[model samples]
Target: MKIAVITKTIITSFGLLILLAPQRTHAQLVPQPWVSVGGKDGDVTYSVGARALNWGAELGFGPDSATGFDLLKFLSLPVVSPYLGLGYYSEDKGLAVSGGVQVGAGDNLFLGVGYNSVRGINGQLGIKF
Candidate 1:
């Protein structure tokens, strides 16, 4: 199906980006923690995650509970960090694919808009610490 192909492409791209990242000792230990609250369709969803280098993972809860892994730091824009993610949710729902742009509000705050295949359109307000 189309979704399967897209998912494969995303995973492949993430792997390529990770392999291309610079080798830095400090980057491996630094964790960027964040909290996100949003709505998918009519269901409320929230997540907490951490990013280190170009990789991140989140535990999410809502109409469905899921765990997601994202490739962060792929784009080097000044104020916005764009990311792509893939996740597996409970119930019969399978893979969830997502992409979003995060805009920094301060040193530790960000706002984002994203769409997930399983979650619908979502707007997020988060704090990174």
Candidate 2:
């Protein structure tokens, strides 16, 4: 439904950016596509929102696999941006609140660390455009 549309839009936009501009795209390889996998030992719960200067949500993976969503802002800093987020995890019960910082190492390369309300700590590696 609406989720599919939004996903398509993002994909389309990213594709266009990749195709339309090669030099610039290769130089910045930003907003790179990424997915993360991790684990939490204790019981956990929380809800998350991820977008630039905005809040949002997802179904969540619960305790076992918490699919986290993060919002990346590039205006504040160069090579590094302020990261903010909230996510619904599976562990403790459900949703968990989280936030932190994101740093870009190079084109299509970056990593981040944030605090998870349920997991105690959360880490992620990502790419950008």
Candidate 3:
């Protein structure tokens, strides 16, 4: 019941973003490559990923290591951009649902915090190209 409500909310939100994005001429799809290293279950885990447009994918490693693919939609907001993702984690853990906000520090730098159902919570510091 809760998951169904959340999924509906996300789909509705993304639909709105798609409908409204075309009105903004300055909007650009920036390709970003990122590396994240954090701990899961007291062991170090890492991921390397790339994002373009409203989609992203990563390969994660640790005790509960898995390859994950996600669809992310970023809100067009100043200072902070909020995003949400739903992914399948294939390996030791099954599925992962995550969401986070990216705060820009410079042209190519941002910081993020996210939670994954299979891996718990993690922080990410990444450089966007």
lDDT of 3 by residue, 1-129 (tens): 999999999867775664355324555477777777766678776776666654566666645556666555566466676666666777756666666666788988878777666555667777766
Q: Whose TM-score is greatest here? A: 3
Query: Model-by-model lDDT, in order?
Result: 0.66, 0.46, 0.66
lDDT of 2 by residue, 16-118 (tens): 5433432322233222443333346664533332322212222333355544443332223455544334444444445555445567777657676656555
Window of ten residues with lowest summed lDDT in model 2: 49-58
Models sorted by lDDT, best on top: 1, 3, 2
Which stretches of candidate 3 lie above 4 Å from their native place?
A: 1-24
- Candidate with the larger TM-score of 2 and 3: 3
TM-score, ranked from best to worst: 3, 1, 2
What TM-score would each prediction reach against the true structure? 0.66, 0.47, 0.70
Model 1 lDDT per residue over 51-114, tens place: 6665667666656564444334434356876777777777666777777777889987778777
